[model samples]
Target: MKTKFNYLIILLACLFFMACNQESKQLKQSQLPQNIDWEYQMAYQRGIEAVNWSIPAVSMICMRDANFGLGGSYNTVYWLSAPPTASIEALTANNQTPYASIFLNTKEGPVVLDIPPASDRTAIFGSAVDIWQEPVADIGPAGEDKGKGGKYVFLPPEYGGKEIEGCINVHVNSYQVFVALRCIPLGGASYKEAAEYSKNINAYSATKISNPPEGEYIDMAGKHLPTLPKYDDSYFKYIKELIDTEPLQERDMVMGGMLASIGIVKDKPFQPSEKVKKALKKAITDGYDYLEYMFETPGFSFIKQWDDRQWMAIREPSNDGFVFDEGDYLLIDDRGSLFHWATFFPRYLGKATAYLNAMKDADGNFLKGEKQYKLTVPAEVPARDFWSVIVYSKKTKAWIYSDTGRVGLSSYDKENMKLNDDGSVDIYFSKTAPEGMESNWIPTNGEDFFLLFRFYGPQESYFDKSFELPDVQILK
Candidate 1:
């Protein structure tokens, strides 16, 4: 009997071993591939994801480099002499006001931005942001100082320095910071006057506070500052520099790991393998087109400003002003699409401005530059300050240059524009002026274009939907 029991136990043991061996074989079979082809595919996917994830950072770096190309460096201010023309190759740059750009590096220590007090003639309108384009402080009247203009000191992530008195201290997680302030001409201020007022803004290291050097302001107007990110392997290079320079966010640790997989490790020199580069080359182009598609076909009603009108709001509802940090999951598509077409987002969208984008006309067709259209600006626009309609090339998101050098129409141009009996204005848009409508026409340069309707100091009516702007109508 004992011998029979022993034999049965041995048989059971043999069956268990066989089952374990079979499971092990299946697991090994299901293991991921490690061949060159597999590596290429994985890298390509990672690259695409990386591009979408890092669009803001890449754009910031491109702006930094663009400023560098224009002989503007860290702690230097680059203010436009006039409203930007096609010469300013930035995405959706406003032609309504002159711009001021400053790049600050806090790697050494804290940096200071001395914002001049807002005057009735002109006020600075912009915010300071980290490399991730997260706002550290808003510069002008709508910002932290409430237009009382003072020194905005930006400190590094691990900054242990004592807070300086009489300074608005902003703690930044990244070392590289950028400030894009608009010198808005107001109360009959000329564009050049506004540009000159921006010169009062100063930037220097906090260590030099006792004897701050004279702030250098460069007039970058009419210069080609190519601030657009290229859709190529160079995209990787831009993001690589960003990754190396800035501290990784805690929320992006997993993404950081993924980037490391594709030879974008922080503090490590990036020399991608030939296969990886080939993968990234294709991935970058595809990724860029994907963002363009996302912009055109948003596929969500949340992007729409008014259900009746085709015009879309440039910003989506977010606790973090479209930075996508508050949500449990990242809003990748929204962030990617926004920064793809525009730059310099604010920390919190203030009622001071409202921007509505129009790509399609009333019938839901894309606006063709060759076609003629008219936008009826109502007599009572919900803009306490002013309103403007700027036209930009769909291909580049930059100004469309034509013989007239007219890229937009604003309330300030009311005297020149043709007005109707009800006090509303009719603005024409076509490749050429519609005969008598030259003064009211915005030339599209025969390219597919989009419209940005900006409301400076947007009134409560604009927010409550009581005053809805009419859609662009095709003029036969």
Candidate 2:
């Protein structure tokens, strides 16, 4: 009876251990899929948000700092919001022509006018001015040429005192003008309150200018110009769905990893559930490995090889191979005289890589799949130097499809192209030559791809909504 009881006890203990092992396995498996899904969604969302936030944040910084914007030619415009007690007496003696309008609020009433010293005419006007050949215009005459010669209208304290709450409209052209509004509190107004009012006016002005959708620009090869993606209701809905479905712990882990990738957090102790911690480790490891692989990959090797000097050709003419790079079929020096300084050169290349990376399709293909496109370059595409269209493979970091034995299409090689009877050009993109169209073929390797439209010297058509490029469609 004693031996039989011992055997029963051992059997029960074995059964209990087996049951516990099964439960452990089940729990791990259940958590894994959810963790992975959450990781992917969270990482992608962070990347998208980073790009979105960068635009407004960079613009605001540029506006605040005179060291940036339009090659640093117009920093004084940002100083117009100074305190009321700040002396304009010194300003008047500087021989500075206050083309910008100033609004002042005093205890008695408001004042507004174009300030004095009227000899030096320099303000935030959009266009370039030929100040050498033509004499600077007076306030009355300058107002007429406001938008023409890039002469902006000034608002001064003599015209409107501290109580003013209105804008000065300076005509940029016959059809278009910008309004600079000033909102100031009455006399003995708190500086804090006045500052808040100024901020409100600035916000209002920004909203007005940002309206009116700027049409997308396309290249002759059918690639869209890099622009901010439209944020729509669908995008917000997608974000909401991701947040609701993903576990909070998993989301935090993913976000933390992404932040680490951008050097936001170098070393920090992070403790979460074992599963969440594992997922975070896997994501960081995988992302870095993939990027490393890409650097060594056939088409993407350029990213690893090209230095800042090589990329400078996209902005300035450096003897450091920018103008005479082997891959560049044509070089256009559209940079104006003001941009000749090296200190300001880096600004132009600021968003080039980020813009290229953002050109991806829904399927995670950067620029792959069969694509059909139509583009129109109107007669006399204006540029200071030249314009060219270049196609790049995100997978290869090189031009995907081209018979030119080059990466770019330039005006210098105009004679080499088979132009249509009407002086237009037609180019084809594919992995193989499409039947009879061998000469115009751009070679692809059946991977993701993108294209860049480099306008060495862009004219008004590039900025104005007049010239439009056709949309690209997936053929297959």
Candidate 3:
């Protein structure tokens, strides 16, 4: 009987080990690629994905342009890495005072624009303006030169133009002389590859000016303007062809390839398809088209009208205005300043709530005044200038109540701030009055609210990951 019991136990142990081995085999089979074709496909797909994201980094630098007036002639230039120099010719002898703006796209950046400081008496020619990375913002010397003339200057790569890679120059002169420059880097396999990319972009911009794509015509006032020139249908056809040629991949190889190359993935399992690779490229190109349409086409007629106005009056001290539903998104040109406007489409329903959340976390919460909320800025808030907190009503989507009387924090004098003994600051958000806290109180009125934390001349604390804001907490 003892021998029989021992035999049964041995038999059970063998069965268990066999089951474990079979399970392990199945797991390996599921993870391992079945063939070499799959491996090559995977690598190719990975390469395509990298191209997609990198392509935009290049295109943004290419398509930038700025116009001083509606009838003003447009001047444009492309930037490359090398010695930077730009050509400047006074269109008219009287138009000696020139103004220029630079635009750039960057991976780690608040893309900046430099403005020459104005003359000492005029205070409008020789100053630097650093625009934020958001869709739009501008900075420049204080005050405007209504009459004192300034000359338009162009800085191309290799000249005194700001020493940066992938910068473009768009110079214009009219009622106001302006230059728009952008400094976004282009990634490529080699110098030759980078040069080729730049050439293609220049060609595309030229083509756009001569032969724009066809789309419905509308005016700046959101109305269909009469006698407007129609776009060519061939552009649409070209876009369609590009889309049809591109095919979606079964799996996203871009992420996989990056992981494998970086050693995050010990072994790649499956290969990607050629169709998938093409699709990824097409998607990125399509994104560029979308951006162009939003900025250039009548599809965004409202934006065009706002642009025509040259971003005037929008920043007026007494223009307490609000847009509801369709009016929620207001387009304004920062005029090379550090405060630009953007509209979140589709995903955010073009609502202020969406725009607010999309900003950096230090800007604060979109739902602050919804019920009740708390915002705390650490002693080490990042900025070279000064910082301030501002509140905007979600319903109005405009800055209504703020401690500093401005929409964002500024580098104002210390007497204007209400700080704690430890150098920490606490701000309150509510619609009703907080007793003895009026100085630090931000009125919300039970409506959704947006907050902007502006840092003037932001320091390394803002960029090097050392500065962080506490999560917004709902007190109620």
Candidate 4:
């Protein structure tokens, strides 16, 4: 009886080993796609994911190389002399407000962002985004400093220490973070006043005992600063730099592994053959089309305040603004769509701002200057401060320069706008404003235009998803 029992145990062990061998074979087969076409397709998709994930890093590289680059220095804030102009720069609905940008380096230690005060009308909103375009922290009124002044110390993900007192300690996802602040001219303060105040913001290593050097102010008023990346071979170099610099998150690691097949591995020099370059070029073009479709078409964005409203916040969970969903599963396509079509500004703020150029108006046609439209802002506007509408040329991605020197109309216009009955205000848009409605007019310059509606200090209505913005109605 003992010999028969031993035989049965041996047979079972042999069967188990056979099954394990078969499973291992199957796993290898699945991991190595069937054909060359399948392999190319997989690698191509991985390349797109890599580019989209690190676009912000490329922007920083561009700043470092271009005139807009603040002497190619990190841990320094560059306060633009004035708002962005058409000569250089491209983005959605950048208004005529003073802005400051800082590239913080936390590899050595935690970086500190010294913030200034934000009053009722004149407030500054600073948003910090990690190298992966993830929101690290926010400053100013809508953020930790809360309109008062204090130090915001941004710690890296690998930080090894207890919380430091007297600072807003932010554990970020990546070592390099970009903090862009917009100074809103509150009350009746002039643009120059808000701009000069933006100079007060500073960034330095928290390890420093002595005062960090004061931020250098660059007069970007009439200068040509190129902050967008060039779509060529050099772009991949920036991508490699981003990979080597920041510790990859889990999702980033998965993509990074795949990128090795295409020669983008860390410590491994990128030497793409002519064929590889051709493949990558086509892949990037397709990737851009996919990203544009993410915004122009429908997939990742969700209606924020109102069901029918065109104002859409990104579809990522409201709690975590920049991180994409699917956690471990990692919807790479979702991440690519998110940052490709959107930005990281105002990422962690209480106030909600929407990029409105995608598709507005009841008709859903591209906004053209040839047509006349009206945006009916309801009573109160549901803002703690105020709201404004600015026009941007789709071609330049900058404020449309006009002889009138007017790019937008704020609720804080020198003279209050004429409101209709029931306290609603009607802001108009066209190549030419109606004689009586000039105060509410935003000139389109007879070119394709985009619009951004900013709800500064948004109230409960916006958070509760109760407030709604009316469609841009085109009048005959």
Model 1 CA deviation exceeding 4 Å by range: 1-36, 299-302
Cα miss at 223, model 1 (Å)?
A: 1.4
The TM-score that candidate 2 achieves is: 0.30
Q: 236, model 1: CA deviation in Å?
A: 0.6
What global local distance difference test value does model 4 have?
Answer: 0.69
Highest-scoring model, TM-score: 1
Model 3 weakest 10-residue run by lDDT? 87-96
C-alpha lDDT (0 to 100) for residue 283 of candidate 1? 92
Q: Write the per-residue lDDT of candidate 2 for residues 1-476, one digit (tens) a residue.
A: 99999999999999999999999999888877553466545544454433222222122222222222212222122223333211221110111111122211121222122222111222121111111101112222123333222223322223332222233432111111112222222344433443333221111122223252222111111221111112232222222322332222322455445544433343333223444344444443443344434332323312211221112113223444222222433121122111111111212232111111213333323345365432333345555445555555553333443333434444545677667777766655556655665544555545455555455335565445344433333444
Backbone clash pairs for candidate 1 read none
Show the lowest summed lDDT stretch of 10 residues, model 1: 297-306
lDDT agreement of model 3 with the native: 0.32
Model 1 misses residue 50 by how many Å?
Answer: 0.5
Per-residue lDDT of 367 in model 2: 49
Judge candidate 1 at residue 143 and give its lDDT. 87
lDDT of 2: 0.32
Native-to-model Cα distance after best TM-score fit, residue 189 in candidate 2, in Å: 63
Error of 3 at 303 (Å): 25
Instruction: Kindly indicate the candidate among 3 and 4 with the higher lDDT.
Output: 4
Question: What's the number of clashes in each of the models?
Answer: 0, 32, 54, 3
Q: What CA RMSD would candidate 3 show?
A: 19.8
Model 3: per-residue lDDT, tens digit, 72-98?
222222223331111111110000111
